[model samples]
Target chain A: MQNTPHTPSPETSKQLPELFQLLQPHLKALDAFLETQISEFEPEIRDHVAYSMDTGGKRIRPSLIFFSGWNSEGEIDPNLVKLAAVVETVHLATLVHDDIMDEADIRRNRATVAKKYNNATAVLLGDALFSHAVYLATQFPTTEVCRDIAISMRQVCTGEIMQTMQRGDPNLDMETYFRVIDLKTAELFRVACHLGARLAGFEDDYVKAAGAFGRHLGIAYQIYDDMTDLFSSEEKIGKTLGTDIATGKPTMPLILMRDRLPENEAKALRDTLAGNIEADVPYWLEKLREMGIFEEVRQAIFDEIHKGRNAIRPFQNNPSAAHLHTISELLWNQVAAL
Target chain B: MQNTPHTPSPETSKQLPELFQLLQPHLKALDAFLETQISEFEPEIRDHVAYSMDTGGKRIRPSLIFFSGWNSEGEIDPNLVKLAAVVETVHLATLVHDDIMDEADIRRNRATVAKKYNNATAVLLGDALFSHAVYLATQFPTTEVCRDIAISMRQVCTGEIMQTMQRGDPNLDMETYFRVIDLKTAELFRVACHLGARLAGFEDDYVKAAGAFGRHLGIAYQIYDDMTDLFSSEEKIGKTLGTDIATGKPTMPLILMRDRLPENEAKALRDTLAGNIEADVPYWLEKLREMGIFEEVRQAIFDEIHKGRNAIRPFQNNPSAAHLHTISELLWNQVAAL
Candidate 1:
């Protein structure tokens, strides 16, 4: 591995925010490592596998893995890179499947795997990506990495399943929403941090703390993501917006807005969510702003981020804890800016 | 572990052929073990997981694990049982995904997971099953079982992807058909036997021989399955028959029949397979029967089975070799009967 972190290219840096510059080297290594894995798939589907891997997401999980395992010497641990790749691959596989479920056309400013290839190919290609992720996890010397990954993978799917089952129910409670996000999104984040810290030779207590931090951070990140679907511009986010209500997926803002609406308006909203009536995206987006649900959702995210920071507060002297704090601050800023 | 093999219940015995009676105890243990795994999934999805696990498809892969690990004393090895569960779960997960891609409604005389549940649920449910399988594989003392399983899972997905990609292509050759079947079907069989024999403390040579046997048998089994799709009645097979032709999937019989037809007929057949023209299932079935394609496909299957049997001929002194031989005989008989 290179001793000095590589600089991100201008295009790449522009895609990511300034806060992520510190992870350029680690993410670079992860990209090279993932590229090497393309040949590992069957020759027939290598291109599809490569396409899914190149989605260029924010790499939040990889950042969690890197910062949680930070070394004062600033030498990137190769094991952490591999762990990042494993978690990121799992994340990408979920995205592929998620696109199929959402009937989503675009992701990361390009056609989704489901739109580009077909739903059937997207489904199997996602499975192929998942199998490859587990295969990579097994390359570790011990079973801990694979075991944790398998459990997290299962939880992620379970969370998605719960969300699917609850779709169009309209009365979806905040607890269920939180539970789903915790499983679908936070579970991988927790495992990434836990495994990253453990692999970096951190103490047991610190590892546990890092996991808690990740779990809280994951919850916060997901809320922000859910908010963006209704609030962010399609051009700025590089994807379709206002899909939550359109697809009848009850998110934090929708739930809050529903609760605050007048009885007749709420029934109409419920009817729309239940698919009994057509979804009016503009109406819901206006309601969200009128009800101040956007600021409320942002505050909810801020609270979770603060909880995450408090998790590693006792380890303030540790360099990893400091890095983790900085990363949480970045999330806080993003949410605030939104 | 039971010291004596349990007799299969009459209902199960009737469902399965007489040849599987020797595996009653092992299959029973696997069923119980798999039932216990239902609780391992999230509470919300446990029923769905249980439903998927109880499909009662012929446990050919588990049988391979048991037979290859057979001891003269007939004592069940818990390790082999766990190994069987791992491979079986992976197979079930693949079946769940396969039903979605094939748009298959019924499997093993009942609705497939995809049919019973929505496609999105089926997709995530399949993912959960795959994750659980890897988790089970990681329970072994060493990384070998999990490592081998992960690799096999990737190969299986790759094979399925290749087959999916080849779905409407009239020009798919015999080599690609063999390769797809090898990856999609044969990989799990090979891994089951390989891991089963290795776990049974068999000699290295015997372990390798068992894996070879599994690969050939797997190839033979797939050819037999493809043949049945064209030749069998719905009452006998319990699935929609002649789907390969309708779906434009070029299997062994279709490939053979296409090659043997005269120029004009062959062009028409090619057009049908390419979706340029509607498939005439009755005509193709008639062609398959008249062209001696059924007998040729049977011969192809027999060749694979014979090769499989020959792989373990040198290890006849080992009881496992005899048991493995008996399993091959079962496949041989099934093909002959077909």
Candidate 2:
């Protein structure tokens, strides 16, 4: 963890108003390609699926997949776009199912597919997305990328299962948390890099570079997730705050705080974690804050994002890779500001 | 439902010995492909998934898909192999999830994935299979194939939900049952056919024939399932008899028997359906037999299967398509014998 809080000082944070503009042409073509691909379905299913896909998700993973390839192989080939679509579809499938498993009512400020259409429909739709992803991975230029992407997907499932078990467990260790995060959050990002690089036929050092960049950015991205859970506004962050606490998952901040707690205070924190979500929220929040655990967690998030930015400093000169590098820095800056 | 009695009747049963033999080659391929795809995961997770797929359950859906192509287009292209594989995986995903939802200890004479693994793992494993199926489907050569497959997969999920809600209700109308069966079992079969026809690029009346064949066969298949539940050998059946009754879902005979039952007996049957699985199985079986419901159901099973054979007969010239037609007849013959 760093000295900065969840609300970072202006000096560390940056902005990227033109980033979307920069990526617009490729994004447009990607959307057009997907539209043509999906237009033949039962209209409602296709519309709902595309609605989720084009929900303007930060194209972070796809960008990594694209840029990693370009940096490694010196061009963004047609294969990168297809791989991008596949990776994004895989991510979308997880979100659709996660909403059902979590019973989450809202995501990205919209009714989740599970909430909007219904769980059964959501499950099927998610399966549809997943099926599309697997089918598309073969479109990648090589069998190697196909195999790696598919393996990463199974790893995502492993991560989801691991996370499901860890939920509501205050005693969850940091190792388990990282293991889960790495799978749930980082595996795709890591794969995104590898896929991009692989598509470019960048067989060695560049592949490692792409993967390393994604790994650090993914860590930074997740630390931002932790910070958002604790400190971001519902309007700005797009969901409820302290949701992890509400769900009783011992997230990074909470984990750091538990270790630092006095025995009696730690027991209080543990009790709150073990308590049912249907119980009193204010009482639990007060207890958590009274223990000074929240502040420690806030700082830990900033430190991770800071480390993430530093990790990418080596790739700044590559203009083709600039958007991805910029987004990582911007997200971290926003987390610090928040 | 048709006229088979609630006793061993192996002497009259028909077998798909030759068709199953023809399918043997592809079955081997399926096994090898599954091994390669899952071999990379940790052994524990790999085994959990493999236990479900590796079980030598019927490959009805895949056969339908391949045969649909074989019949309409005159040959089963090797390229369409993965399409069949994906459809089967979708079916297996539904079954794995169904086992958990049903809490069944056994399927195909062995423990289900849920029974073998804990419920949490089993649930996620089902999700993984669904994801993997989607991933696999993306490899289809055309976008329409992708969208059509997705639509069919959606139907399967909806069918499962319908079945769950209708479980244990003797009053479940036959129309509702038909719809449920169509969604749960028939839709995938239809998709399999649709995929087969789509891949073969039949692009005409052939598509309609393939779909019609699949839909009718799927219905016949479910009808035969009803007969098998009441009349087949415990060993031959691979699981306990009258399990659906135990779960409270009214099959054809039960539905008929409910209407035919003397007031007291009808009330008793209804009570059992509404009650827990702990209710005496023998008691219901005895009462059900006294009404001759089993015989009535078996006759109906024959009627449907015979209809299915007629529907699929147009494909008789193609070897793979001919086998599906023959298998449908044989399966029906087995039910009629029972």
Candidate 3:
């Protein structure tokens, strides 16, 4: 069912500006880490890849990875940073390929690899990232961590597949949507914390705690993404938003909103989506807003952030705890922005 | 430049046939091993993946892996067998995906995954197989082995990217072609043998020996494939074999054949390839046969096998020594079939 979008409170939004500042250095480290890993292959591979990667994004994934690792509270090795970068690269891989699968033309306010270099290059680049992620996965000290990371990869791929399958299916259920997001987006967040805990030599409960933290956070973040695209306009949101709705993505907000509609009105929304609308996005955009999906998803985002923050309660006292707190707060701040 | 088609022959191919056949049982055992390792996940994951895996192929990659483990004379753990099967699965992952990339309709006399289900299903199935392999990889006795196998995954993907880049480009060099094949097709073979030796408690020298054997054999196999695709009809080859000639792939036999062609004739062959002249397949086929490419590549296959056999001489006394011979026999037999 549709949940309303989470609009940010002015106070929370201002509070996390410092978190973005904190992420700047981590982003730099991540950029270098990414370059070095790609460099292991011929330079051309990295250059082609880095060109697309250099486009700016929020870098939320790496930040999550960092929080997970740094919170482990033991001697952190350079390997953790690499692993953090690995998490980001894996995300980048999914983004690059996902752009192609979705036939998306714009990402991060610029032409996607598929748009810039052509689909073949985008496909190859996506493959390279997948390859390189696995390549970089080896540096961890134990095979257990590496294996943990590897398992997460399957989840990511499976999630993407599920998303693709449900893509234009108006009848797509809410439960399947959550399962897809958990596997596709949240699993990495879960694994990132788990690996971070293991690398820090944290014991069993700590690992579980980190995993739960990342999983919930990731789910919250994705839900927020779904919410924003439906509720916010490009100018107001400060980016090109709402393509998900136009593409028949049947995101949570729309699902919830549709549930509240009269049967005829609901069927109209499905029919609109079933047309597989892509062009003149604003036309479909107006339809969804009229259908009350925007408010519904917005509220859902708020609830998710509330739940996500709750998941990290167990790790509050740990040294890396602040970063974890900051990451979640930054997410909450996004909801507050909505 | 275009080169004429030349089929490889078993009499002149690299590895031994009987050994490849012997490794078949081991390969089957490895598949069984994957089943055991896969059990912790939901049964749906394994059974869905098994749908494609159980259909099977010649078991080329795992055979190399089993021999690699055997090469070291280490205790045979079912783990190594499982590892070998997973490697084969990785190769399968590439094949299924590559078929999609190439828009191929068939693989091994059966409809390809993409053809059988659809692009979406095939992509997911390939990913599922990949993830399943990674999941099974966790069961290996050592993390080090896992790391090595993971690296092999990178090589496969990179090889694929490199090969894709070369597609439809007549300017691709023999050196570039070889490099692509080594990465795309041969790296797995190298790992197959290297893993065998490493698992069996073999030292660095043994690792090197097996690596050497796999590399040479893989190269020969690749070259043999090139030649057969050019010379054999699709009906006889059991696949739509002429993409190399069709897409202007600069494979070895073509490169060598081009060298032997007169300026005008070479120009004409290049013309046919650039045109993807399916109707004139016989015209190019005749041209390749007349240019003595059959003899040149046949000689090259003999050299690769000679080299492959020679590299394994140090392990001649190992229990898997017959395995190495069988691999060489299998390879040569493939050439002989051509």
For each candidate, the alpha-carbon lDDT, in order, equals 0.87, 0.66, 0.68
Candidate 3: global Cα-lDDT? 0.68
* lDDT pick, better of 2 and 3: 3
Writing each residue's lDDT as its tens digit, candidate 2 over B1-338 gives 23243332222222467556656666566666666767645443676666778878677776666656654323336656787777777778878767766668888778887777656566678777765665565564444555566567666665665665567776777777787777767777777776677677665555666676677677767877875676678888676788867778887767777777889877777777776435567776776688787776666665665555455455545444555555566556566667
Give the per-residue lDDT of model 1 (tens digit) for B287-337. 899999999898888778777777887787788887887777667767777
lDDT of 2 at B121: 65
Misplaced by over 4 Å in model 3 are A1-15, A71-77, A118-121, A237-242, A276-296, B1-24, B35-48, B71-76, B240-242, B276-279
TM-score of chain A, all candidates? 0.91, 0.83, 0.84
Share of true Cα-Cα contacts across chains kept by each model = 0.83, 0.20, 0.35
Q: For candidate 2, what is the total of clashing residue pairs?
A: 24
- Using lDDT as the measure, the top candidate is 1
Writing each residue's lDDT as its tens digit, candidate 1 over A1-338 gives 11111222111212235537767888899889989999998888989988888887888899899988988875778999999999999999999999999898988778999999999889988888888888888889999999999999999999999999898998999999999999999999899989989999999989999999999999999999889899987877766678778778999999998998999999999998999999888988888898899988988887787777777777876778878877776677677677
Question: Worst lDDT window (10 residues) for model 1 chain A?
Answer: A1-10
Query: Candidate 3 at residue B11, lDDT?
Result: 30
Better of 2 and 3 by DockQ: 3
Top DockQ hit: 1
DockQ of structure 2: 0.18
Candidate 3 versus truth, CA RMSD in Å, comes to 5.1
- Model 1: per-residue Cα lDDT at residue A41: 85
